[model samples]
Target: MMQVKSVTRIFGQKAALDDVSFAVEKPGFVGIIGRSGAGKSTFLRVMNRMTDATSGSLMFDDRDVLALEGGAKRAWQSQCAMIFQQFNLVPRLDVVSNVLHGTLNRRSTLASMFGFWPDDDVLKAFAILERLDIAEQAAKRAEALSGGQQQRVAIARALMQDPKVILADEPIASLDPMNAQVVMDSLRRIHDEDGRMVIANLHTLDTARRYCDRVIGMRDGRIVFDGTPDQLTTGVARDIYGADASFNEGATSTAIETLGTEGDDAYAQSMMA
Candidate 1:
């Protein structure tokens, strides 16, 4: 299980998170939602230790996450893999090599440091790409793939770390509708099939309700709501994003039409009420 206690973060006098505390014991997707500057991304950063909290403790299993330092800190980060909004793959590197980078912490020796990755590691990288169904693009340069494909490659890279948890911060912010589904599906498949823990920061309430096992709402650095996807009512969303404001989801007309066709109106209404 992952636990965060009374987490408070501040920059100058402005609080980014105010005494936020939550836990996730299940192994499916847990989504973080809020408007811009709502402290959604900041919370994800603290989870992965990308940024430290001004106060409170983060723990995984029995490990004191906030106490890790030096090589241990690096390794812990590897164990808790992160995927970013912008696909952070090396553009000049082939997809396979970029995926292989996940193993760097384990084999940062002189020879491995010189790019002499073992054959076993190579096989592992190939297997990870296959797992994400992107082995075909292994040889392609990361710059050559579409935004969706790059994100998938990024997922594969994270998987290569053999992480205990996956943290994705605004991962679909740049994709088109089709690409967004493509990326979300890949992550969902991983969560369901591999049973690894996933924490995603998202903008679209619909996607969060559909894809996440639990939805966590934050505003001005405090957790306002946290519950299963079914708990993400329209009122809840309106509370987070404010009412009457259009939220961009990159949702396709076809996807929305399909949702509307298949009792989505009723589903949405019931939850909202």
Candidate 2:
């Protein structure tokens, strides 16, 4: 479980996260939705300690990640890998090499300091690529693959670390519709297949309704809403965004009236409404 206690972040005179608090049970899939500058990305970064809050505490599984020091912090970070909006891969490195990078933690003093390591995990890295369905590009440079494929590579790199929590900050924001589906499907499959905790930040309400088990809405650096997809409605969305939110599927908290193959038929009903 992860507990965020009255977390707040300030940027000079402006508040980025204003006393936000939430507790996420482990092994659950969650989606965070908010407009730009709503502190969505900042919240995710706080999980991995990529950014520090001006005050407040964050705890995971009975451990205070922020208090950890030296190798303890490094070990905790290795167990929680983050995937960003951009595919932050070594563009010139082969996909296999990038995945092997996840194993850097296992290296010893001379090996790490001198940039040397034990036997390469090329075979294991190859297996991760195969699981992500991007094995065919393992020998290829990271820059050569398509946008969706590169994102998958990034995911595989994270998996190679065998993380307990996966924090994705807008994993599909850079793709087209087709590519977005591919990436979302890949992420969804990761949770369903491995039962790993997936926390993704999304811009579209429809995507939240379609993929997440529960949606958390943030406004002005505070969480304004948190509930199952079926709990969403126009009124709820209006509070999250505004009156125009109803017309913009990207901003609404869509209520999943029926848990079907692809959730409720909001498309047909809302379009007619």
Candidate 3:
């Protein structure tokens, strides 16, 4: 379980996160929904310790996440992996090599810097790529794949950490509709299959409804609403986006359904094999 108590982050004179408090007691897909500068990214950064909270407590399971230091802090970071909007892959590196980078915290610094991964670590990378249905692209350059595939490769890298929580910061913000569906489907599969906590900063109401088990609505550095997808009604969306908001279907139902079918096909192939 992750417990955040009265967490506030201040930048210079402004408070980016204002006394935010929440708890995640179960493993599922969680969506943080808000407009630009609603503090969604800041909140995720604080959770992962990418940015320090000015004040408050962050407890993950038995450890005080906010109090961790030195090597312990580095280990904590590995346990709570982050996925970025940019995919963050080395464009020149092969996909498998990129995924192997996830094990850096556990490997020898000199060996990792030289790209000398052990056989077992290489196998683990292959397993993660297979799980993501991108194993065939293992030897390809990270930049050679499509946007959605690159995101999946990024996810594979995160999984190599064997993280307890995956914080995705606006993961599909730059993808096309079909690619967005594919990425969301991959995230859903990870949560459903691995039972890992997946918290994503989502940009659209439709995407949240389609992918997340819970939606957290934020406005101006404060949480405005927290509920299940069904509870996120049009009225509540207006409250989150504003009265003059025009919410469009970011990913059409047809696109998501098609992606679902593709996932089913992959599952069937795995079963057959």
Maximum-TM-score candidate: 3
How high a TM-score does candidate 1 get? Answer: 0.87
Per-residue lDDT for 151-191 in model 3, tens only? 99999999999999999998988799999898899889989
| C-alpha TM-scores of all predictions | 0.87, 0.85, 0.88
Instruction: Mark the regions of model 1 whose C-alpha exceeds 4 Å error after superposition.
Output: 244-273
Per-residue alpha-carbon lDDT of candidate 1 for residues 1-273, written as tens digits (9 for 90 to 100): 778888887766667778989876767699887766667777777777777888998878878787788988888998989998888999989999999888877875686557787898899999988887789999899999989999999998899899989999888877898989988998999998889999998877778878998889877678888898887766676676554445344433222222211111122223332
Candidate lDDT scores, in order, read 0.79, 0.77, 0.83
Model 1: ten consecutive residues of lowest lDDT = 257-266
User: lDDT of candidate 3?
Assistant: 0.83
Candidate topping lDDT = 3
Output the lDDT of residue 99, model 3. 98
Which of candidates 1 and 2 reaches a greater lDDT? 1
